[model samples]
Target: MSTDNITKEKFVLTITADSIKSTDPRFDINNLGLGDNYKALDAKFQNASGTIITRDYKKGEHRNTNQTMAKLAFQLFETQIINLPVEVKEKFPVYKENVDSELRYGIYSSVEDFNRYRKTREYMQYHYGDGKVFVIYSWNVFSTILFVQECLKRFGEQGDKFILTYREKDIKESEAETLESNVQKELDKPISEYRNPYSRKLIESKNIIFRGAPGTGKTYLARQIAADIVSDGYYDTYESLSEEQKQQIEFVQFHPSYDYSDFVEGLRPRINDGVMLFDLQDGIFKKFIAKARANYENSLKNPEVIEKETLVQEEIISFLNEVEFGVDQFKTIKGSIFYISSVDDKYIYITIPENNIVNKLSISIDEIKQMLESGQEFKQIKDITRFFGKLFATQEYFYNFPIFKAIRGSRKKNIKPTISTEKLKKYIFIIDEINRGEISKIFGELFFAIDPSYRGRLGEVTTQYSSMNSKVEKFYIPENVYIIGTMNDIDRSVDSFDFAMRRRFRFIEIKADSTTAMLDELSEDNKDSNVLDNDALKDEAMKRMDNLNKAIIGVDGLNENYQIGASYFLKLKTLTFNQLWEDYLRPLLQEYIQGLYNEDEIMTTFANAYGYNETAEGEADEAFESEG
Candidate 1:
């Protein structure tokens, strides 16, 4: 994407998703006068001109991945950090590939070195056209993690959000592929076979609102997008996430009733000793923000500092692992022998516990460490209950607490925060049905904080209930936290997202066809004969959908947003095709034409176009697909 075509007012940052860019002159190695390069060999020799850079080779895949963690970072910067525009996207920075940078930053040592790299003589002679070889170190393209970092840095939620695609290879193998080519392959992959690159890139740069028709799988896609970013493109499906990884995401459904108090922070009534009392509580967004901020801060901490405080915990863990299981070496407060089973970062498993109701019981490592570090004497379950509050006040604590005490009694070790390694983790906040709520009422002063350019301390908001805070502290969303919202184009709420708040987010139209990948789940490739052949059924569904959508668009107000999405056909999982049409699709279409001047005629047109026929009540289930 060139600057001439960009709408400078479109967003606070602009990201260009060029095809994996080898064909572009930006990646051509001999394409000299290129902006810059990285050179480690003659470090200071070329700096006399004051532009050349010397960087060590040690910044390998980790550096690239972080830069490619396009999801973790945002668009590259246009100017100095402080000069970033808050209300509109920054001016596109003028960038070009230069010989100095190509030598310093590109994969090859220099343009000459790249030309000389040919261990695969036959392959190069057959496949490597002189201009086809892509190797440049220009302003990163394909909306790179480097570019996202530069562009989206305006919005600051600091966590390691990696969106990586490059693979490691031995340079000596005479590699035939370039990083741009590898990325191109990924981008070109079909939706059913790959994550949506557009969604990933959009959410990376700023908070996104997905506007589309109902059944577009907008809500589902929104969460999946979050999972993809949180995984740093490692995994896209939300179900694939482990319990620990799932904690990085939070989902909320917005309704007309949702307000600032419910979203930001509010007071809830709590009965304390029989008297009703109001207590200030963190809203879901605020609570999630706290977690994101903790990770962001920990990621910034010096590893050596954390390690210094973690030695004792490390020694205790080593001793526990070294101990043999099934020996009945540890005992509970009742003196019932229990054997150690396993230990992980967070929990300890014990085998053959006195409580025979189950084979083994797991205990928290941090809780034990917390108890140990407190220097508090525990005579009974009450002490554990007092320390951890009501959650651990159960009978399970009675057994587990003593084992922790027994283990610690022998080792005399205390585990601190250092026992848990710090990593930059992405936190995703997803709001389904975002348009249902009145944006201004729900967000209030957050409109200022939500701007991509105003992230961090500069965008801190003294929330509505500031007096409830201990010190009237200001709250800010961290750089690592990303927001995704879904909206139906035809929602009837009187109050909608305010224009100002709309400007704070990047809005993308999620057309019905763009989300047909959802239909892949309905496939029954080798099921019983009674079930319809999935491929044929899918094709039929797609054909009918196209006819109906094409007809709908011909109407005055109806457009792609009014068309049906693949998600509606998901009913084929249990409901038959006719059942889906009559019960679901028909009613939705009727509703669409309810107030039209030719309501009945339009409804008939839609039904005919959709191929609806009550006579063939059991219309053979047709396969369906959506792609853009």
Candidate 2:
């Protein structure tokens, strides 16, 4: 149960030389003590700093010694002191800490000899290669080097020979550490401090699908999970993020006709130079991937250099102009065709009165700019523009001028890598009703790149329409980009999704039990004082819903897989019980039972289960009471 003794180990050192072919074998370098150079070896050792040095000479006898070498292979580990396998790290608690401290682990050898032996592929298989005298340096590499130097000096006397040795020991955890004790300490931590196990699985898998019935907060939770990843851990609820942080997440939906042109890069018709022509345009996923890649590459750069690339005022002005220019169309008093002629610091001048008369009318942009600069509301400009004494006044048309222009900046400049506050800033692409799309047809060649194992630069591919663009030949999904999808499992459309996509995505089911509480939070307060308070209605609604689902699952043609989720009851805050049953629930039940052989009996059973009868009402009350 203790790791005190596990960290300690003993090692022994040995030295030997390779044999040489000779007519008189006794005179070879291998036969050191018997050779004539034995006298010179003694003299060479005498010159060493040691007090006395001598060599023993055995006449006419070849001394052969095969000494044991200590195990120092574990020293090669760089990130940690111990070169333990991943299995060992997972099995032992002491090895799991982010405890990084200075510890000894390395292999040392004669550079010349290692290079010489490296020519042969057989010798290359060895960790340090076949050196003349390989030395593995552990904790006492400095002392070991001095010892080897003296040996090399004496050995050189026999011939032009070199001696080298490397020795190093792998240390795990700390000098004073125990695996059992560490694991016990970790277990002692409160449950709130421990991360969710599923988060780790999601990180490893990279792609996930949240399959359930409609309105289970699948898209909502996807944004939160995506934020958690980029922040390195769950920082707070998604609502707490600053406007800038929220930009890192994206949401999209998929339908039957959605194809590669809408999800990846494709040639699209655009009015370029007054001529309609197809030009390459990046789709939502591709655009997000490009942003993520830029952030990732910028993270590796020096912050000072990024700071030198100043945020000039001209660039900001240009950006503002682009945002305003995007609003090509406008609305007027007659409700049709007004073109935004020009947008300047003072006014948004436009040509108005479509199809009959053409004239210029200007609305002051100062109010909108003030609303942006100071987070204060401005009084609605009354009687702003008048034409023919009609007194035209549309607040929305004048106020909301800068469309698609949401900008947030950090106070500090280049304080962190990846351009100011962003480092490895991730982008999440959430595909709602994922199964409704033709998966293979929509993703095109991106299917290979989207695979979890093949993510990042390793999976880069030349896109199908790459030839259309002069500069770009390849595209890749960065590691910081993630995909989350949601669908109803019972939908017939689910069957049309490609098998290849199914294998790539980790499927996580959102069930009624996990999401029904959302309804209670929504119906917490009654909007109108005249209306009856329905704070407790969610429980009653859920009980009837659960009972209906049970009947649906037990039906002859159906099973638990097709059971309805509690999302159907979310509108109880404003809807009456009678309205929900008579208008919505009854018709939905009828549709579910329409194709069944015993249609009449099935409808009767469903209606009763949904609290249409006295027996069903009693059962619902009993279930709710027991749950409470």
Candidate 3:
């Protein structure tokens, strides 16, 4: 009756036959009077189903003759007289005098009996617990210690004894197996993969812009980040990306000329019936979104497709193996001859000759075999001979099958198929020099959709030319398609960025440290390859560039934005100290110091830092004037 014995543990309550009827004197079964011949009390309880249920036996007995307690007996029986609310109001509560406890005591016939009681409740409640209380349900004696509100209110009067009667139920083997199997599956999967740094921010914001000074590796880092997300940690660089992964990525430059007509959907002039007519066409961004969306939706419908490609390929091969062939391998009708060349873990190779057109029929190998067996002539699908080219094993088209059209992430021949697996693919659109283009003009109505809170179809809006394309009246940027844009702070100040576009993107700054690290890598590579005439030259080059950047930053109007990057000095291998300054660094410095009163003096100081000679300085001045 003391609630202090309860401990916080997993809800797995195990009760054995011996625990109910033990030989020990501390817990005597004979005293309880639960034996083979004992009969239950006639007392009954009504359930929601209106079924009148009776107790097998209670701690105190009920006799038909005297209506008094009978001698205790013991025998395990399976049936409950009263329904106990499995719907527990509290969960995992520490039993204390002052605190309300989620832990409740009830007698259950079996684990399944407890589960049934749980199904009728709203909150998640389990019947499993570290046993501190005992329960038994049977026709001979239904004995269990229960915590009831009525008994607790009158604890001193009741003397801490609350007996309940319930029946036992059987547990099925199949039900036990299914529960174990589901638990095993849940345990096998990894909990974290895309949970990398910046992933949460990018996922929430949906759009991010990487802005920094030139040569800060903004473009390189963007591509790496995009590759990482798309490949799901399988790839992090351009060279590491698979052909399919490459398809999920797109790179473009934004300039003054870039517009909505080129970036999104727009009306284009087309020659229809020998007359010029305007036709609505989707631009790169829209097309990319479609591809990403198709993959995303397909992934949901077929999640196993992500890692189960080999199984699909095997199915295709097994189906093809059943095809009946006469000679020279498995040849299709219509003279489009093809045979299974080989089969590997990842691909099913089908060899077909150049002249052997394998189109006209658009179906799986199983379907074709069935049709041929039924003597059904297949109608030729015109201009589909090229489609069969993808099936040729020589071209790595093993996964292509008629059952489900493959979502090829190839940029070429932007074919819009009815089904796609783009959702499975993390599509990235990298916009270089993003601020160079007019944001309001290029994005147009898509500005609303770019906001992270407004992402997905919920944020869809009608485009400017929505009236022209009935099929695409409303458009939204998909969640899977990540956007990355890079900008040079020197070219366009942060203040110049539109406020409308500002809140939508998470901006990250890349500084001169990135450039220095890049140079260090280049230097190490040159040293290992023995390409440098003098190793010390690399160090001097780094110092000069760093000093040059500081000097530019110190200039009256010029800040870190206008500071020269390491890329300029990275050309040190072929050019000497004087040539590097006179040809590249000096000419560039001249441009930076242009229109200033101290221009000549500043040029002299920069030239001196580069150890410029009188002749080299004269040549730099002449080259600067000619450029102007």
Arranged by lDDT with the best first, the candidates are 1, 2, 3
Expressed as tens digits, the lDDT of each residue in 391-491 for candidate 2 is 55444444243221222221233433234633445566778888999998888888888987677666889988875432344788766667888887778
Better of 2 and 3 by lDDT: 2
State the lDDT of candidate 3 residue by residue for 1-628, as single tens digits: 2223221111111122212222222233323332211222232333234454333443222232111111111111111112223433222121112124233333443534544544221111112224322232211222221222222332212222222222221234334333333332322222135533544445545678877667667777777677767767666577788887888888989888899999887788966337576656779888888787766545444333433443333444555455443233433333345544544343344555544554211123432222222332223332122333322232122213221221111112432323334224467788888888888989998888877666566688988887543123468765567788889886744556778998778897777656464455455545422333345556666766777777777779877766666666666655555677878777767876789998888987776665566774346434432433
For each candidate, the alpha-carbon lDDT, in order, equals 0.59, 0.51, 0.50
Which whole-number lDDT from 0 to 100 does residue 526 have in model 1?
29
Q: Give lDDT: candidate 1, residue 572.
A: 70
Residue 573 alpha-carbon offset, candidate 2, angstroms: 2.4
- Predicted structure 2: lDDT: 0.51
Stretches off by above 4 angstroms in model 2 are: 1-201, 214-217, 227-240, 304-421, 528-535, 613-628
- Best-fitting candidate, scored by lDDT: 1
State the displacement of the C-alpha of residue 75, model 1, in Å, after optimal TM-score superposition: 20
Query: Distance from true position, residue 408, model 2, in Å?
Result: 30
